[model samples]
Target: MPLTLPLAELEVGKHLYWQLGNLKIHGQVFLSSWVVIGALLALVVVGTRKLERDPRGTQNLLEFVWDYIRDLSREQIGEKAYRDWMPFIGTLFLFIFVSNWGGALVPWKLIHLPSGELGAPTADINTTIALALLVSLAYFYAGLSRKGLRYFEYYVEPTPIMLPFKIVEDFTKPLSLSFRLFGNILADELVVAVLAFLVPLIVPLPAMFLGLFTSAIQALIFATLAAYYIGEAVHEEHH
Candidate 1:
């Protein structure tokens, strides 16, 4: 008898489609996203249920995360404006962190879908683009609301020659942000999947651990960049 290995079946670009009138959506992505959202909401609820000067258990963890996020926003957006944007930045970080970790840690493969498999929402193009677009809108709103009509001056303040590039940047910013997160997450998932298929045992453990670390890092990176963008928009240019 000859020994043979089963071929790994990788699923890519496959979406569990849902149709609503003229609109089409990815059901799997939304399903996973809801799971992530539910997890976050549960943690928040439990953590805030009992407020105390001396935190314990889930409250302590929540407070640590909150303080860390606050510090990050303050460092990027400055103390004057960080408080206003802390919620937005913190939500982004927590959502992404949970999504990434859940994708890796959850036994999503056990749940069989008709089309696409369940995974991290961030790994999807639509989700990342939506998040990136939100960041873009946040900065634009921050700038226009804070500076009024004078916000347009940012396009040419450094020099008139910089106007064109600055205008182009508005488009590039969201594009880069969306693609960066989407590519990194999707690539990570694919890499881990391929490794698991090839080894099917002890070999994939290291890759799984590394994926967890990168997932957390990506969440931090996305949140930091979002805060930085908002900070730049609201920054007071000293002449």
Candidate 2:
């Protein structure tokens, strides 16, 4: 008997895996990812080419987004260090935001792949895990770079009783981030796929809209948490 994943074969990028050397790559995931990234780059180029004083069209939208990101980072990471990390946090938020909306709106599944279907990159567990690991690394870098050897003092702050829990938290943080994102995205795709497959018209519309809202929320939540983690690492209590 052949094994099968429940409700995954017909929806999103879960049909099969592409083997590339030692790595198990999903062709659809990368395909959509590159497409979305390319579009974003093109927008950046077009938006910056003119640079008018009033900031019209794409420039205005870009500036608005930039300011929002800046404010969010500042609120979470504090004034001193937020400027340095804003770009990273902004990129993470934008990528996830676009990817999620793309999955819900773009008919990527219409573009047939040799193995799997194209969905949001975040819908892939591997992509989410990679992103979560990057956040983990970013916080570690933030802590070590700002505090040097003193960063270790975080684990025992207040008292030594938090040492074990703090150590466990390091492992759990990445796991939580990855699974939460992957699960939410996959579930969104799943519901939309099932509705479209079954009703194929008006039934899926509501689900699709809900998916977009949830997608944005997920991106915001992920970015906020990431900035908070970095902020915590870099914050000094000043005793």
Steric clash count of candidate 2: 0
Which has the greatest lDDT?
A: 1
Instruction: State the local distance difference test value for candidate 1.
Output: 0.92
- Measured by TM-score, how close is model 1 to the native structure? 0.95
Model 1 residue 38 CA deviation in Å? 0.4
Per-residue lDDT for 111-140 in model 2, tens only?
Answer: 776667888989999889999999999999
Name the regions of candidate 2 deviating beyond 4 angstroms: 1-19
Candidate 1, residues 1-239: lDDT per residue as tens digits? 27544432567888999998999999999999999999999999999999999998899999999999999999999978888899999999999999999999999999999998999999999999999999999999988998997988888878989999988999999999889888888888988898888888988898888899999999999999999999999888999
Candidate 2 lands at a TM-score of: 0.93
What's the TM-score of each model vs. the native?
A: 0.95, 0.93
Best by TM-score: 1
Stretches of candidate 1 off by over 4 Å are: 1-8
Q: State the local distance difference test value for candidate 2.
A: 0.90
